[model samples]
Target chain A: MNAQQLCDRYAAGETEFVAAPLGGFNLAGADLIGINLTRADLHSASLMFAYLSRAKLAKANLSGAKLSGANLNQALLTGANLHNADLHGASLQGADLRSANITLATLLDANLIEADLRGTNLSGANLTGACLRGANLREEKRTYSSSLTGAILCNVDLQGANLKGADLPRANMSGANLREVNFRNADLSEANLSGADLSGAFLSEANLSGVNFAGALLTGAKMERVLMTEADLTKADLAGALLIDARMAKTQLAAANLTGVRLNRADLSRANLKNANLTEAEMIETYCARTDMTGVNLTNANLVRAELSTAILTWVEWRGATMPDGSEYRD
Target chain B: MSVQTSLGAIAQTFAQHNNALRLRKLIFCACTQRWESDRTRLEQQPWPQLLQDLYYRYPNPEALGDAIFGVVKQLNRQGEYSRLAQIILDQLTPLYGENATETTQFLTEQTQFFNEETQFFAPTAPHLDPDDPDTTTIITIAANLNAMEQNLRMRKLLWCLRHNSWENDPQALLRIDLATLIGDLQQEYPTREDFKQALGQVVGNLSRRREYEAIAASILEIINPLYHAMFSPDPNLGDALPPVVMVMEQTPAATTIQSLETEVHLQTAISPPDLSEFPALDFLKSDNPTTTEYDLKTSTNFTPAQPPPALQSPAVKLPDYDRYGVRLAVMKYANPLRAKILAFSILNHNFTTDSHEWSSLRTQPFDDLLRLLHEEYSTWDHLVEKLTATAAQLEAPAESTQAAEAIAKAMKPYYIPSR
Candidate 1:
């Protein structure tokens, strides 16, 4: 149907317009509030700056649609085919895009604040510089597993977002603000999270192996049992973080500030922690064999039962620190 | 002596006393952690290259052989079997014939020989040796004095004390020596007497027991002062021997040290044990602390192992909500805006002044209006009755009763059919 007919029907109080074929139509700056466009064919349609608040577009074909700078606040687009859609700088706040096929979509600079994207297929989507703060992308409800697998989320602010069980493997989230985000059981393996702020984030049971956390601020983050083998955490601020039972073999934590961090029962074998400040960190039962700890300050740190055999402790200051056998290593 | 003779003498000395504490210290100092990589490469070189490098760096054959033997022993201690075997092959092939079988046999025998030599030179417990208990205290004092004599400054001071005169010495040097000028250093330094007593006791023990070998070793420490004095720059010190040497010449200590040189010379004459055979020596000697020390170093210092996999926390599997069920559940809560719009149309088109439901709906809170609608209109028949009754009350004589019918037609499509 043409844009004129849709507008005329909407003026006549026709809110039910399911399965309407409105492909390639210029609906720019249109007010379609509270309209039902369920299963509608709006592919490649120009919905730029359109008022789509409270509109129902469930299972709609909006692939390749130009929705740039559109106001989609509180819109229900569940199971919609938004593949390759241009939603740049669009306001998707409080919009329910659950189970939507948004693969390869350009969500650059989009406002996704408080959006419910649970089980959304966001693979290969370029969400660079997007605001995903407080967005519920959690897969807590099992059937719809929300994932950003291989998505470019660089410079995105995801503070307080629920990303539980999300498949974010190999995602480039560098400089992203992930503060207070729930990353429980998320697969972040081989992902580039360099310079990301994950402070106070709950990352328990996350598969974080080979992840680049260089210069990232993980302060006060609960990273218990995180599998971080060969991960580069160089100069990262993990101060006051609880990393209990983390397997971080061959990980590069050089110059990282682990002050007051709890790494109890963690395996940090062959990790390069040169010049790292581990002052007062609790590392009971930690396995640190062959780890290059040159110039590390373990002042007042509890390393009780820690196996540091073969670890390069050259120039390491363990003054008054608790030894592996529960005895203080004085001076 | 010729270079060959000197090298032979050095090799003999090293092989005989390879396990001595003093030799161990020298070996460890030469093969420090800094030179470990260089040492590894050096072991891979051919026997001719190894010999030439050793001789060129340390012209003293005795010191060269000792250093090489130290390297070999250190490699063995470190459990570098491949490097050790390669080095032994390089050394043995040149000593024995170029026959592969003979060289292989000799290499195998050398391992056992070195182990036995290590055990033979091991220090015994103090209580195990009857003479050790009585001599240990004096030996310890003499050892401390020996250590002090090894100091470069102490060597310089001993030389100065022997050459410098109290009145003729420079004023600055004389002031420090002035204290010693009035009071002998023996009287000024408290430990001086202890050293002298220990030295005297060791000398006496050697002379009475006729243990010329022990005397030869003890007198080396005793003549250290004379050795330092020989290097003095005093013009008056001309061709004259140091005072301690002159004193030792008058005693049996000189003969003991002289006998060592003669004994080494005699051994050189005997066509030195044709190491070509390289007979396997018993290596089950239990007293060697070198092996134990090496074992402790490698095990405690840096045994690299993989981290255990049991540290990973069990992953929490989130509940996967069925999409259809989730959609159905979400539909249970009618949108408040839609419900309010429908309610407004109902109140505008059909409302009765006498109906209890209309009065109840007006009295109910705005937030509870949806609950009121759900509770008031449970069945279609009940909803129709209320609409028709309200329509009947609002109908004028000229107007048709079509307001209730219009309201039902407007809301029919929005309502979900009950199962």
Candidate 2:
């Protein structure tokens, strides 16, 4: 049926559009519940506010479609092309979006609770305030993205993404890719980011309290003034990174790479930096109270005006490094 | 002190312990409630500490069992003899040989009693029979029991090693013998060939040993049931899993080729003829090649204008007041009954907002709400006891149940199922 015919049917209380040939249709705000539009070409269609709950739209072409405020709960849209689609305020709870091409899609304020987005291309998408609680975003490329507060991005991709100002508090982003991402002002408290990649990321002033960055990468990253209280950056790479004025109270950066990094005025209170590298790094005016820098490398680095009270520097390499009191390195 | 006073003191101590438990519960409840109202506060809270603390406190076999028994006794009052009897028997298993035999016996007895007396607390419902072997719960319980048994056996093995009992067994010495054999084989072959031969011999020897077979069987039994669960047929499961990333590096030759094309196009357009009129280009028209080269070099040294500082830190903190206000407003309109149910559920499950467990609980099927509620009630009871004890220091009267109820009421609005 043509777009107008479908619209006529929908207006007659016919919510089901099974095997309907409404390709390239603009049926915005049409309630099409339980529609079977499998393999239909809805390319560039405007289905905003359309109720397509439990609809079978598998392999459908919805590229560049406007599906904002659409209710697609439990819908099957596997392998569908939703690239650059506007899905703001859409309800996709328990939807099957596996292998869908959702590149550059706008999913702001969308409800994706328990949606399966595995192998989906969410690159350059906007997911601000989206509910993706329990959504599987594994192996998806989500670069250049934004996911603000109320967005459940637990176990989501973020590797190589620019997530500046993203709110991911209480989200389980464990085992995600966050390499080279910018997370300034992001709230990632209670988020599970264990085994995530954060190499070369900028995380200034971000609230990362209770985040698990264990075995994560932070090499060459900028983390100035970050609140990382009780976060785990264990075995992370911070080589050549800037950590100026970073608050890392009770954080574990043990065995992390800090080679050539700047830590000027950074707070390392109760932090574990065991076996960390600090070669050619600056630690001027830094607080190292109760910090574990055991077996750290401080070669050719400056520690001018730095506090080391209750800091463990045992078995550390201090070759050619300068102390706060202008003393030459002895070890 | 009289027996009644002694009992009261014990109850008070239990209450104190409960208060501590409740504080932890409150933190988790607050997290969920806050998330529902305003997720921004999630950023301010310390989550990792909360998770670690929860992991350390709960699910510790020793602590959990003891705590459960203590709370159960404190909440229920009957003759002292029955309670003391229960305590003595419970403590005996660990004190005796640390064997599962006594513990298993006690657990079995309790399970039977609870199963039979369940109707006393609530109306009788159609029960699934374990002997029928057709029910899903029965199968699940059986699987759990099997896994638990295997875990207990492993624990025993570890315990034996710690106590140096392994040295007493000739068969246990096989591990050392195997190591020595591998070392000897390495010297003789000194290569993969030798390694393979040594491995073959070890495999042959292990195949002959009943212990090795038993160990292998136990491992398989424990893992087999989980195989289907891990690889469910649902397409959603496949979608939830992450994909692998591969980084491809471009070679210098390829990179140079790409840049060379762009540079050549630009160079041809800006030839010496086009610049001959300008004073700066006069050097390019000179017969001396060195002057032309110098002029070209000087022209290339044109610096671009310095851009504004894009990387500079923001001078002012972004106000999250609006988000907080929105959340508070939401809480105001929240349903109290739902909040109480949600709070109770959270408490029962030991849901700490800062914990991975709470997140996991949120993902559970809606059908399991009753189970979740039971867990929440158990947790709430503990929390109330703890709050009462802590409030004792304050001069003003404190009612822990009332506080808990209020919290529940505030949190109800955010407790709706995603479905």
True contacts recovered per prediction: 0.00, 0.00
lDDT of each: 0.57, 0.48
Q: What is the DockQ score, from 0 to 1, of model 1?
A: 0.02
- Cα lDDT of model 2 by residue, A46-112, tens digit: 8866778898898888888878657788999988888888775567878998878777787654566
Q: Once superposed on the true structure, which residue ranges of model 1 sit more than 4 Å away at CA?
A: A141-143, B1-419
Docking class of 1: incorrect
Q: What is the interface RMSD of candidate 1, in Å?
A: 17.8
By DockQ, the best candidate is: 1
Question: What is the C-alpha local distance difference test score of candidate 2?
Answer: 0.48
- What is candidate 1's lDDT per residue for B1-419, written digit by digit as tens? 34344445544544454342333323333434222211212234433333334544532212233444455454312323323323332332222222212222322233354455554221222222223322222232222222221122222233233333111121122112111221233333234323323332222222122222223223334333322332342222212222221112212121111122113211111111122121111111112111100010111111211111221231333232222122112112322112222343344444332354433432332223323333345333344555555545542311213434433433333333322
Poorly placed runs, candidate 2 (over 4 Å) = A1-155, A159-162, B1-419
Could you tell me the lDDT of residue B358 within candidate 1?
38
